[model samples]
Target: MKLDRKNLLWEGSRMFLPEHRRALLQQRKNATKLAVPKIDEQQLETMTYILQEAIEYEQPVLATYVTTYEVTCFCGFVDKVNQMEKYIQLSNGSQTEKIPFYLLVDVTWP
Candidate 1:
């Protein structure tokens, strides 16, 4: 009796190359990335005004900022502003975050 090897097509070992896996991951990450938005001069002035007001009145605010990959929303109080560095410190009870002036998208009181 002779066993046939031609019928064992599905019995071969499955292999995944590391380079192929990395390429797949890169594609997925690029798909989720967002483009940076343009902020007009009027909008920039508005955001600056809102942030300053929040700081002076000790009011809570909602700030929307964007990065290369995503947009983030932070609900917090304006703790401090660094004029030289052009960044604002936001405190949300537990931790503080330093958001740069250019990344600011919108500011509102809630």
Candidate 2:
């Protein structure tokens, strides 16, 4: 069977827009449904202090990497935490990468 280029292009483009719009709507809906835990100011301050201490002490922090619709993965030995962006900087041998805080599962003290 042979396909017409113009017809194929038109059909493909028609299919793409609805999928993209659905994905965008679903993402927005999911974001609206998220229920994040809220910590009081004092507790938040303490957690920040602890994180700073961990960074200064060179302790290994454990974190979990979460995806939109998957079982979370674990990341260990996080060397730096960026609270502002809710991400952590981790070291694997000589390499390092920044990952989201929601992905972190655990932390270990030095």
Best by TM-score: 1
TM-scores for the candidates:
0.80, 0.40
| Backbone collisions counted per model | 0, 8
Residue-level lDDT of model 2, residues 22-64, one tens digit each, is: 9999988787553334446675565456567766776655444
In candidate 2, position 16 carries an lDDT of: 58
Overall local distance difference test of candidate 1: 0.86
- lDDT tens digits, residues 44-103, model 1? 888878887897889988889897788998999998889999988899999788998778
In model 1, residue pairs whose N, Cα or C atoms come closer than 3 Å (at least 3 residues apart or on different chains), thus clashing, are none
- Looking at candidate 1, the ten consecutive residues that score lowest on lDDT are 7-16
Models, CA RMSD each:
3.4, 8.3
